[model samples]
Target: MEFREDILGAPYEAAELTLRPDDEGAVCATLVRRLVPGSERAVLYVHGYNDYFFQTNLADHYTALGFSFYALDLRKYGRSLRPHQSPNFVRHLAEYDEEIDEAVRIIRELDGHRQLLLNGHSTGGLIAALWAGRRAGRAVVDGLFLNSPFLSMPAGPAVRTVGGPAVTAIGRMAPTRVLPSSLNPHYTHSLHKDHQGEWDFDLTLKPAEGFPLYAGWLAAIHQGHRRLRSGLGIDVPVLLMASTRSISTTVWNEGLRRADAVLRADDIAAQGPRLGRHVTIVRIEDGIHDLVLSGEAARTRVFAELDHWLAAYLDVPAIEAPLIDAPLIDARPADARPAGESA
Candidate 1:
């Protein structure tokens, strides 16, 4: 794992990690890092589906908080995508373990970081929670931060129940079969500079119309959701943040900029407690699906909530971090299901 200057350029370095080949022939994941001098703690971030490690502002925020930052572009996505591979295809969510384990080893053992925090957004959030749960009591990670984790499907329970087995069976028979995508392009428009948003990332890597959704991939995600719903007993402190509401629309609307355009915040809040006993669920008003990418006022609240939580839970000294404002809802849902209950 030799580090080289990343596509993001100076001060941000990237390393290519070779993993055991899968049905796709060869596989790899990229680890991008920006180290803060003499920082004892580090953060490992995983981006959502159709996304990569391009949030330099996020890295800047962590570095400002005195922690080194790293991001992973998982196999078949972003920097790790290869010419011969199907975009973002995986038979099982557990397949991610290989790269995640390697990244953790490099961060903790090779880099000599004393404390580690795992941060994930959207689908990455679900992956992080499941990974943390599987490694519960291992102490490999000190804290978990989820930004609008896709814990449950956006559809009603009936649709999930009826479609789950069908998708799995179809996935088994034709793993690469493409499924019709309902991914809202407005979300992409809401984030990219060419549209209504302010960020400038590689559109080819995270296209306005995302990569095809595969049956096998959806099946794997369903399996992961089931496992999470059944409970993995993650024992570490977990900070789960999501938008206060989700806006689902076919046409472009200004509201898309202020609310989550992907996963539902209600679903995320409902499943927050299932993560662990020490979970802290925060709802940021006017926050987008990726809380960090929200508008200025909302992003400020998101970071403030994170800072307050970290100060209380991770032993990070609070630099006069103010109490959470009223716009931020910092409570578990009243009807939160038990750890082992079916969602």
Candidate 2:
């Protein structure tokens, strides 16, 4: 249900963040913003590939937490796309730093919120994590919330290891070359269009025929993945959420109802610690690829876990800083034990 209160009641205004052509003469990134009237905390959400900010409810969730939400539809994705540029194509993930930096500057100036949180989903999740790592000790972010982040190559090792290089090379050479993909009618059919699915985002804008996978995009992703796997010294606390099981992008099945079908849950569990300081990995039972967007029962379970984490982290009183400036750990640094213990 829509909150009865007037959202972003005052002074808050929606604005656009624009960048001009670099030496390449290609204008890039138009960051979008909708500031809260009088809210203090701000959240910047980055969406996954083939995704945009249609989940208005998620924005509401953050508003309820007293955070004004702003979502970025990256270059060549969603509202940021122009006629000339290709959709969802990039050679280096670092190239996105410009857009992200622009967004941050806008949020800080407009809302002036001390507590800034970064939330991302799927590929967006990876982007946010990498951004946070880059900003470590820079006093840029308060915490990070990654929901079912796509950290590793979703495709199996064989294709990903071999095909990835090929895709990157091809993308760089001829980014316009169309790749083959077949839609799974089952998954598409099940999504509630008006209510349950509750979205009619333009396929043209976010095409069912996803944009090409040029070498630039593939190479950038490989580079980003490598950085994530190497580990970042994120100074802030983090929460990583995922489904209890892995569901394939393969055709729909009753099993799809209960698993993350997109990302391997084990990957999330294994890499949770690699993210940063004091990380918590919560697995929601029966959750789908996007837990918050999951079907009925799983959705409830997903929110339940979210509540538990928030209560423990955000809701409770802040712990007083210890007299001595030191960190306590059950394990030593550079020491990664088995999954269960580390997580």
Candidate 3:
């Protein structure tokens, strides 16, 4: 494994891991690392669907808390995307086990880090939880941190119960067939600096329209959700963080800037406890789907809560507070809304 400067540039580096080719062609995974010499603890992060490791501030936060940070761009996603491969396509969620296994091996055996934390966001959270459950007796993971894990279908029960089986059945016959998608561009708009948010990233990598949703991929996600619901039995301590509220909308609205426009926070909170016996759920008021990328105040609250949990559970020191550069546009008064509208 050779390390090179990451796409994000200085102080960040990535190592590529070539894996067996799938039907699509050659595929690989990239492990992005930010290390401080002599740090005994490390955190391995996994990104969600249509996402990559562009949150440098998150790495800085973990570094401040005395932990080395690493993120995995799973095969066909982000840095691992090959020209011949379909973006983010996989027939089984377990297909990721190879990459996760390699990442853990490098962190534990090669890097010599004694305590390792598994951090995952959205779909990544579901993947990590399932892996931890599978590896419970092995004692490889010290703890688990989930950011708005996709516990269930965002659609209500009717769709999940009725449409889920139909989707899976079609997926079995034609795994690569694209399915109709309803993802709104508003969430992407809320996170990009060019649109309405503070951070900037490659729109091509995580486009507003997003990559096509394939039947097989959706089926894999459904299977993972089923496994999670049945009980993961993950022995490690788990911290699940999410926005306090979820607002569904097809049109642009100020509420989309403050609340989670992606997954329902209630679904996450409800299913969080089932992941393990020792699961702690924290809801951040006015935070977005990705808590780390929320507005200044909410983001700060997320870090503070995470720091507190780490201190209590892992005996880690408190993180020295840093001045936030992003403006808290979402921290407006409760009654605040665009003008000319009457409630």
- Write down the TM-score of every candidate: 0.95, 0.80, 0.93
Q: Of the candidates shown, which would achieve the greatest lDDT relative to the real structure? A: 1
RMSD of 1: 3.4
Which TM-score value belongs to model 2? 0.80
Writing each residue's lDDT as its tens digit, candidate 1 over 151-186 gives 998887899999999999999999999999989999
RMSD of each: 3.4, 7.2, 5.6
Taking the tens digit of each residue's C-alpha lDDT, what string does model 2 give over 1-343?
Answer: 1112222333223344566554334655544445566877788889987766666667766676566777787877776677777667776777678888878877786458777778889889888899889989898887888888878876666977897778777767865566664333344334447323544555565554466655566667777887887897788778888876775655547776677666677666667788886888867666676777777666655555555555576562322322222222232212345556652
- Measured with C-alpha atoms, the lDDT of residue 292 in candidate 1 is 94
Which of the predicted structures, 1 or 2, would earn the higher lDDT when compared with the native? 1
Would you list the C-alpha lDDT of every candidate in the order shown?
0.91, 0.68, 0.88
In candidate 3 the C-alpha lDDT for residue 80 amounts to 92
Per-candidate clash tally? 0, 6, 0
How well does model 1 score by local distance difference test?
0.91
**In model 2, what are the clashing residue pairs, if there are any?**
168-215, 171-214, 171-215, 172-215, 192-197, 247-261
How much is the lDDT of residue 41 in candidate 1?
95
